[model samples]
Target chain A: MTSATKTLELLSFFSEQHPEIGLSQFCKLTSRDKATTYRHLQSLEIVGFIEKNPLTKKYRMGPAVLPLAQIRERTVPRKSAAKASVEQLADATGETAHVSVLSGTTLYSLVAVESPKHSTRAIVDLKTLPLHATASGICTLAYGPDILTQTAKQNLERFTAKTQTTEQGLDAAIQRVKETGFSHSKGSIEEDIYGLSAPLFDQSGTIAGAVSVASVATRFNADAERTIKHQLILASRQISHNWGGSIPNPIEACWSKTLAET
Target chain B: MTSATKTLELLSFFSEQHPEIGLSQFCKLTSRDKATTYRHLQSLEIVGFIEKNPLTKKYRMGPAVLPLAQIRERTVPRKSAAKASVEQLADATGETAHVSVLSGTTLYSLVAVESPKHSTRAIVDLKTLPLHATASGICTLAYGPDILTQTAKQNLERFTAKTQTTEQGLDAAIQRVKETGFSHSKGSIEEDIYGLSAPLFDQSGTIAGAVSVASVATRFNADAERTIKHQLILASRQISHNWGGSIPNPIEACWSKTLAET
Candidate 1:
């Protein structure tokens, strides 16, 4: 990677769980020496991408990101267009529903809502979903850019026993997603969570992202899966239409066949 | 600036008005050569900070910022905490209400709502509010960090005829804000907009940002000014409380005296 790109990459280490990172913690996380890590932090800090907390001296996300996100929404309003559908999906499925946007090879979490019906739920706390370990990632691999398959192959970090850690296993999962028009991952990212995802399209007529329902594994039976898939199709179409694209006929056919056969 | 800082600074050029920017346009805007600008754009694009539009090839903000913004809101929640109050201020005052947060030396626009009560209104379409010109900036200068005054004096970019371009003029305006517990700028940023703002505080017990109402200059008479000032105090208090802060005694006294005298 270029030096600048490497510097920017440090930001990805932050997540809702690890919202603040001290310099030494960052160094350990990135597996880089303290000097290089500190310099990268300095670069990010100067641009207001990160700021040090007064009391803890740890760095958290800075305010500079607000305007960029606002401009991004104003330019292509993805979140506002998808929020209602995701909320409805969550309500219908009685699980956590979310939208992710495919930018380059990564699927960045856009918006997520969790249903209050269940006492136990799957929390979509990840900033970026693993392309091999999550339903959303598999959905993107089935319909997104071709190079994403190669990208997913290069990093097959195992999250659970069910996560595909080999190229052959990953490819088989992706092929299943293509035939079913939905991607399902049972205890891949987390041991007790099941995720079902449908691809979302944008004006460019390409797979722009995925709408996903993450459910508690114990509650995800065949009937629950059917209900989730039905809601996912409706949400995919609603969000895709709002984003100025339509569900392709082949994917529609796959959905019809899969639903009928099941 | 470091090379990474310089590269990341390229993102600041994007706004609601100029969302997409071409490589040549970026070069012209920053007065840099083609090769360096392209490399910087490449760096930003590689990290998904900016992406090229397929049809236009112009670079706009990418999906990467969405996650960062989400993390920031999750950490600080400045927007959600401030949104309803700003909307209420807009509704009560019948003007454009906005909130800005001070990040380092810049006052970044956090959230804004325009009242539908007026056909013609001031649009708060800025990414960063100028510290020497806007009411929000002046309010920050009055009550925020001591160094902000020096920062504002150094830039002194004149946005309109009424903008304080000199240190003396700017200091005088800040003094007015400190004494009255409010900042008022008439046609300072835009020719026909009058902005009145009050400082917002956070858990740190210091000025965190400002909540302001911008109205068309033609409609900003004494009666309207009284209404806006009355609503601004309530809005600022409400937002500050939601942000885990309260109006300081001196500022509250100033507000009481200003309201009582006016």
Candidate 2:
């Protein structure tokens, strides 16, 4: 790598897993001499990309990134971050794919994409998804804040007969979603729709939203469901990463187990 | 500067003033050739430090900074960010220096430093500063949210004879602070403490807190006041920059006019 590229790569090392790095740890991580690593670090420090902690004498990310992150958010909003990932998920699944964000306890649709491969695929027409009647809502209740469960219970609007209209049924659905790492709803919100979803997270490491594939019920089979689940995982990972978060290990393990069984 | 340093300097070029830059603008700003500037931009883009707007084709900050900023806040908390600046302010002004943060309508002291220049110095003993009786609280009322005015009027307790006890007196004090860019109080919160404060901002471009230098009443004179104001401006700027903000232009102009008059 070029010297500039190498210096820039040093920033990527300061992540959630490793928030601070001492000079020796930097040297060990990069497999470089202390002098070389220190020089690169100085370059970053001079530009306020890295700061040395006074108490621990370790280097951490500096305050400069806060303003840069603000600018990035203004220039490229969260909706745009998920647009490409949703498009890719729709293309891969040959069905309708969408991303939703939770504000308070309500799940709002951010963006949606539909595949050209399907002549009559599911269409996303709702602005806000009911917390107890959709796959995305179930995924959110399974992973989001505890208060969301109370909110979901209070608004158990029955969109269809299959929708969980009682708190007991909603709790059961949420329990299944927690175990499977994917939420599934058959004819819940819509009579002809089968929705499968995975939770999305943001920098706060909490469940920020969900990514889902809503397919036509008649076209949904065991093979299609397996394919949709795989693509949903990819979409969830991509969207979460784009939003500056990663999938938690437990959810990833659940997906692995569910895929193994599938 | 090394090539790495030069490339990293490119990140500093982005600010609230110039959030986006075209290729020609980058070349002009760095005084480098187009090819060299493009190479540096490419290096930053490869590491996700800079991203080009697909429509405008102008480069702005990337999503990577969000995670880095989050990590920075975790490793080096806001209290730590203000600690060094407050210490420097105390040393420069030879007085007690402190920072107060606004949460909702209440202002709470974050840190305090005593210069040890005198046998007797002002002590910051309060956990929460009264909104109507202290220089730091007045500074917050001047620049913080409008609801703060109502909050201040609701509880105008008289601590000392010079404290602004009436609504009209509080309004006059706030108006003067807005015009002068500094808040001043003589024996308001304490019997013998003279407090002068400047507002501090954060990445939100709003008043997050105030940096104040509290002097002993007997030690306060015109010369000491002038020197304290100068140091207060520096402390405010440093603390605000450390908190990922800059002094607004109008506030900077107000400081300049006040200093020039003094």
List runs of model 1 lying over 4 Å from the truth: A79-262, B79-262
TM-score of chain A of each: 0.72, 0.94
- Candidate with top TM-score is 2
- Candidate 2 lDDT score at position B151: 89
lDDT of 1 by residue, B1-262 (tens): 7778889989999877898999999999989899999999999988778878766889988767876766776776778668878989999998999999998999999999999998999998899999989999999999977788887787888778888898988889989998999999999999999999999986456798999999999988999989999999999997886564668999999999999988
For every candidate in turn, the CA RMSD to the true structure comes to: 20.6, 2.2
Give DockQ per model, in order.
0.21, 0.62
lDDT of 2 by residue, A1-262 (tens): 7899988788878876788889999888889889989999998888778888888899988877888787766666789889988999999999999999998988999999989997999999999999899999999999987899998888778788798898999899999998999999999999999999999998778999999999999999999999999999999998888787889999999999999998
Best by lDDT: 2
Local distance difference test, each candidate: 0.88, 0.90
Candidate 2: TM-score of chain A is 0.94
Give the CAPRI rating of model 1. incorrect
Model 1: lDDT of residue B18: 93
Model 2 stretches with alpha carbons more than 4 Å out: A166-172, A260-262, B15-19
Task: Give the per-residue Cα lDDT of candidate 1 at A231.
Answer: 99
Query: What TM-score does candidate 2 get on C-alpha atoms?
Result: 0.93
